[model samples]
Target: MSIYSPLPPEMIWEGWEDFKPVWQEIKVNGRILQVEMQGFNQARVVRLLSTDPADYLNSAYQPGCILSFSPQQSTTPGAINDNPPV
Candidate 1:
């Protein structure tokens, strides 16, 4: 019997798209915040990757803001990164 099972949490972002809702990293007032958005929907402000959630909440949200995502070598099945990279 093989003992190499991995369970990862499911990440859900409202209004998800194949490649449109791209992940982004923004610099707000010298702090960095990771975000992902789809259409005109409210952008998802990633918390775990940021220094503080409060900073993101207080910072002005501009959908036109441009950012980049870090590359992940491997991603868990059914996770957000499961889909082909954007």
Candidate 2:
């Protein structure tokens, strides 16, 4: 039996069940994503790395909003600055 066949309704996103991350470069077409690298509030804190303040100008983004990033670097956990940027 297929997973989608047995699933009840309301478990899909506009008919698609699974999601693939939308990967995007930090800067494209004069646009950048304001991402939240840490914390719940004031999230999108990762924007510190982006020099452009207009990246998120008049944009609505909340904490826990997923962001797509690349370079796929891994950082060690623990005390702030303990590891290189991820």
Candidate 3:
């Protein structure tokens, strides 16, 4: 895939190698969301793992939107226990 940003690649991909995003799956309004952890209790929406078209229409789950969530320990391997803040 080609990125057509006016900025130079160096500027656009600065720290790309060191940029390791913490990805987590979260459930919100009965929809599963893949998010990148931005900081404590904060995560940025990456994508919605849902088959419903209505889920894509919800502004709250849009990519780049920041969401607040409470962290929880997961007992099952590869399972997400954190829930978005009410």
Best by lDDT: 3
**Predicted model with the maximum TM-score:** 3
lDDT of each: 0.50, 0.42, 0.86
**In model 3, where do residues sit more than 4 Å from their true spots?**
3-14, 71-86
**Candidate structures ordered by TM-score, highest first:** 3, 1, 2
In TM-score terms, candidate 2 sits at 0.20
22-78: candidate 1 lDDT, tens digit per residue: 676644456665677534534455532445556545534433453334544444565
Query: Can you write out model 2's per-residue Cα lDDT over 1-86, one digit (the tens) per residue?
Result: 33565656565335474554343224324555445344332224233234556544533433345544344333545434565455
Across 10-29, the per-residue lDDT of candidate 3 in tens digits comes to: 99989989987778888877
Give stretches of model 1 more than 4 Å off: 1-21, 38-42, 48-86
lDDT of 2: 0.42
| Pairs with steric clashes in candidate 3 | none
The reply for model 2, stretches above 4 Å from the true place, is 1-48, 58-63, 68-86
lDDT accuracy of residue 19 in candidate 1: 52
Model 2, residue 59: C-alpha shift (Å): 3.5
